[model samples]
Target: MLTITATLRCQGGHEDVLRDALLDVARHVAAHEPDTIGFFVSQDLADPCIFTTYERFADQAAMDRHNTSAALARCFATISPILDGDVVLLTGTELSAKT
Candidate 1:
């Protein structure tokens, strides 16, 4: 499995935009991409402006399709202006998991 972790910070007041975009696209991804095994999103309790998304894909091809998907593109366009700085992204091959 291919796993992706993305951490982003919003520009203080744009939390709604970030939240909305992420929520909307997450729904889209869930409904449209079957190969995307898991899609999870979270916000930091201590830091309101910080958020993270964890995604698991079946393989590289599945990840590629997701990266090129239109919903994700739209999400990026919507949130681009509100981003505080460069997003931190990490990728890995899943060694093991409970579920």
Candidate 2:
């Protein structure tokens, strides 16, 4: 399985907008991407403008597909302008899990 985590900070006064856009992207993926095993978005309690997303896919191909997906492009279209900076991404291979 391929796992990726991203952290982003919203531009001033745009936190809600960023969160909404992320939700839309999650919905689209849930409805259309079979190889995406998990996608989750969350806001940091200590810093509400900070958002983090966790994405899990079947493999590199699945991740590549997601990168090229129109849904993701649409999401970035809405999210980019409101972002404070480039999203931080971390990638890894899953070693073990119970769930």
Candidate 3:
């Protein structure tokens, strides 16, 4: 399995917009990307403008498909202007999972 984690920090006034956009992306992935094993989005209680995501893919091919997906491109297009900085990301092979 392949997995990825991402952190996004929104510009102060755009927290709701960024939150909704990320949720929409998760919904789109759930409906369209069967090979995406999981997609989890989270918001920080201490910092409303901060968000994190954890995603699991069946394999590298699934990850590649997601990387090139139009939905993802659109998401970036929508969020880029409001982001405080570049999204932080880490991708790696999954050695274990809780479920």
Which candidate do you rate higher for lDDT, 2 or 3?
3
Each candidate structure's count of clashing pairs: 0, 0, 0
Clashing pairs in 3: none
Model 2: weakest 10-residue lDDT segment is 90-99
| Estimated TM-score for each candidate | 0.97, 0.94, 0.95
The local distance difference test score of model 1 is 0.93
Off by over 4 Å in 3: none
Residue 43 in model 3: lDDT = 94
Computed on alpha carbons, the lDDT of every model, listed in order, comes to: 0.93, 0.90, 0.92
lDDT of 1 by residue, 15-68 (tens): 989999999879988899999999999999998899999999999999999989
Q: Per-residue lDDT of 1-99 in model 2, one digit per residue for the tens?
A: 999899999977998898998899899889999999999999999988999999999999999998899988998998888889889999999777667
RMSD of 1: 0.7
**Model 2 pairs in collision:** none
Q: Write the per-residue lDDT of candidate 3 for residues 1-99, one digit (tens) a residue.
A: 899999999999999889888888899899999999999999999999999999999998999998898888888999999999889999988899899
